[model samples]
Target: MTETAEQAVQFVAMARKSFPALSSMRGSGGPAAAAVRSAAPMASHFLRRRGEDLLMKAVQVETEAGLANVREIAKVEGLDMVFFAPVELAASAPRGQEAGLLLALETAEAEVKRAKKLLGGMLVPGRSAEMMFAAGYDLVCTTSDVILVRAAAENIVREAKPPATGPKGGLVRFVTSGREAKFARNDETLVTRLKKSRQARALGALVRLGSAAAAELVAASGFEVVVLDHSRGAEDLLGAVALVHAASRAGAHSLMRVPALSQAHLRRALQVGVEGIILPGVESAEEAHALVELCLYPSRNLRDDSHAAEARLKNQPFRRMDFSFAPPLVEFYGQRVAEFSRRQGEALLIAAQVDSPEGAAHIREIVKVEGIDMIFVDAMRLSGADVERIETAAKKHHRLLGGLLVPGCHVEDMYRAGYKLVCAASDHGLLAEGAKACLKAERPVE
Candidate 1:
């Protein structure tokens, strides 16, 4: 059996084995026979992604501990910038310099808005910068900034000591059990959108998660996407699974940038409830076609004949998929996987990363591959002409285009350049940027 065929036998064995204790008991809604103060009147509006409206969070005062508190805020993990807001000048145009105030405000506001319109990577854990990137970026009127600063001020104190006892405890309790990531807590996966609106492009902020806390934080930060950066390989499979659970519970969509395209990696990525996979380093049309087959099972309306592939996969032996789990559990998982793969194209986002000219040269063929929903290109690679050629091909084939939110580029610029998806820098980059901002914010103003 080929690797994919061999692994197919384990599909049903791949049903996530976690979180059955409480999950097996579905809530038909109430906490009991009575309505309580803790219950809301409506279903939660939390979604797989946030809307297109721009968001800005401002840090007004760190009055708790003076410069020490200020420095504390600066060191937060993903905090990106310490924008020097010249409130005195932007607000108080002295009688003689009223006209000049307009110029000062324009220059200051422009300088204050951070670069790249971060994809919700603004606040990690540190205080290097007073403010973190929220979502959309635009010119805020002086009055609006002041109002926004005040609104965000409440969160500075509130998030300082958020409710600690909920999902964090849930992580410890269920993370080891291998919970099913799809339809977590009864919240539908983003895959449902395939059935509803295939033409709706993926838009809005995406935060890469490294921990359960990060997952909750990203979701609460209002980002629509919670991403796991598995480009380092599958060394952290358990950790990635935990993030998926946390992201699902916290109400965000999870996707992964995988290191390779092996059947084991792709199968596990899906079984774990990742909504999408961005596979890196593709150089040929055959590789792209293989990616589709490995990812999309055998859809008759889509890629290949489903019945034959199913039979081949079912009869194959895949020790890789059925390692040390109990026999009964493995049997159950295989069944679930078989069921999932049949309809996975509706939920899974398959992307190909074309970084070299070899891949770019085959852009038309790659974009024509049936199962891929998106194609990601490394902006730092390829000449401008190559990028444009890929862009044209991708659009012509009706594929969504994605790219790096590289420095010297804004999120809007990527959108204008015909990219529907734009990824920001990694958490490491955000952390380092935040750390620098902390130092800059702490320096005594001259």
Candidate 2:
């Protein structure tokens, strides 16, 4: 067996001792486990059987107290990453607080960068590709809000700009009332104007291009590690893949966000070569532990030749070898899931969504799980103060904490509090534009 695989087995064995509950879940007589053993080779089966060993603890924090608490946990228990919630721009620039907001964001970025430099490793919120580029965040998470905002921003810009000028002797010059924008020689203002008039119909096309641009920005920024927010549906997966492909082409790493910790989504994401899986709504350590198992090992319990063939057919050259499997769907599923849990040992990062006080309470136990790597508090559902309280409590329990930012959340406050990785929903295009803007601002003027 490979050293990594062997190491995985050892970790699983150790984990079994610490997390007996996981063993119970994989009941001794469970047909799924037995089926994997009977079908796959003994070595593969052993690796698969040792799935639970690779779990790690992670959490989400959204307040200064929470940040301090997370720092305390990191010092004591080796916390993984601190994801700040809602790393986004304020709607309308926060009415007279734009400077303050910008300063806060800059400060947060500086703090996160400092932590990474000093602490060896750190995760930060990258709602847009520009944010990721500007901050050099380790993890970039795209959100729907950012996407929509970017699209709107792009449309406004496109509409605001006058159209291209056609050939001198060709189409008539069409100009919008706003300052007769001058174009360079050979520019096609007429064509540009026509394109702008048809903007409504071309919104889809623009968004797609924008999405690709965002992914490209993330890729070019040298922050290749990105986690796409895919909690919405399977359709979002395609967009995430597109972004990954674009990012990869530009020299970045990409991970897909799964709807939840289900085998189906995990299987699909893996098939596409997503570097990691972002699981939502994970309420317990058992669930987190199970997710880690699924990510590392192949699922030996499921089988389907058609699926294997399909994966092979759509293969990309940039795909990772970790996902290069051809076993029957059932067997592959069991093997991957089991192997992932056993060998990787908590390396499988999870962004559990906590929307309620009850869920917040459950986070403590979830962090205690041997394999859970991160916890992402959902700001859309939890108040900032409540999230802070949870982080404080979690710190007392020696758990790492993170926070999530949605449409109307106070992300800056979360950053100040010490939450590291903030996410917007899934809007790849917006992320690209934002990244581009950030890049432009940082570049030296000619």
| Top candidate when judged by TM-score against the true structure | 1
Provide the lowest-lDDT 10-residue window in model 1. 322-331
lDDT of 2 by residue, 171-256 (tens): 44455532123223112221122223322110001113326676576556544245555655334545555665776576544555
List candidate 1 stretches off by more than 4 Å. Answer: 1-209, 233-235, 297-338
What would the per-residue lDDT of candidate 1 be over residues 1-446, giving only the tens digit for each residue? 11121222242123222213221335534564124324643322221012112223223321112112333333333233333222222112222232343344333234334333222211212222234322232322222443355457657845554454855444433232324543342224453543345443343333454657756665556656665767763336657767777776767777777778775566566546577778888877788877776565322223344455455435433211321111111112333323445445455677898888888898888888878777888857788888889899988887777777757878777777777666665554556688999989998888
Winner by lDDT: 1
Q: Provide the global lDDT of candidate 1 against the true structure.
A: 0.51
Query: What lDDT score belongs to each candidate, Candidate 1 first?
Result: 0.51, 0.45
Candidate 1 scores a C-alpha RMSD against the true structure in Å of: 29.8
Q: What lDDT is reached at residue 437 by model 2?
A: 100
**Each prediction's TM-score against the native?**
0.50, 0.38
In model 1, what is the error at residue 106, expressed in angstroms? Answer: 78
